[model samples]
Target: ASTPSCGDGQCTLDEDAAACADDCPERAGCTGAEWYARFDPITQEIADTREAIAVAWYATGGSFDAARTGRAGDDPARTSDNVWTAPSEPGVVTLWIVLRDDRGGVSWRTLAIEVG
Candidate 1:
């Protein structure tokens, strides 16, 4: 059988903002925020530090937060921007970025990043 595709102006259970970026794009002109990090020379991947795993929300009047939803237990450092940093340990980590506006409206974006 074939899987259903997104479009038609409806966000079904099968299609999410993350999966269907173009259809559910935000006013910021981006479906989601940007994840920034410096490259790791040793592992050839992103390093685990405050400087890495920082994200920038392109919208105004909102704040962002990050949390590690996987096995590791390291608190991520977050500002209104740079919401979370990847853990120093190596493995697959699920990261959540939550953005909220002054009027109590909220939006969420998640990424399963490899902290190798």
Candidate 2:
């Protein structure tokens, strides 16, 4: 089987932020979630609904307290948090966040952390 290559504008399952930084460019300071207004058929009104998001965290180096974290549709939080333990060695570490919504929406973001 042929291996996936970077710079193809696609981050395949075999590629990652660390291995393919160009394909998975860094999006600094992004929350990876958003709220939108939707029409409620039952209420016959437009309601502001926050998307229920789940974040799949990946990193080249370091350990995360949780692999995923997010709020449900009913939850009001606009953001989620996870704990990451940096590696003992000081160097640049690549991290990726795969955000998924209940409405079949998906996106990803990357971060380059300097561990020193």
Highest-scoring model, lDDT: 2
- Tell me the tens digit of each residue's lDDT in model 2 across 26-107: 7564454567889999999999887788889999999999999888988867788899999999988999999889778888
Q: Please report, as a residue range, the 10-residue window in candidate 1 with the lowest summed lDDT.
A: 66-75
- For candidate 1, give the lDDT: 0.46
lDDT of each: 0.46, 0.83
Model 2: which ten-residue window has the lowest total lDDT? 25-34
Tens-digit lDDT track of model 1 for 53-78: 23334222222353322111133433
Backbone clash pairs in model 1 (N, Cα, C under 3 Å; residues 3+ apart or in different chains), count = 0
Model 2, C-alpha of 23: deviation from truth (Å): 18
How many residue pairs clash (N, CA or C atoms closer than 3 angstroms) in each of the candidate models, in the order given? 0, 0
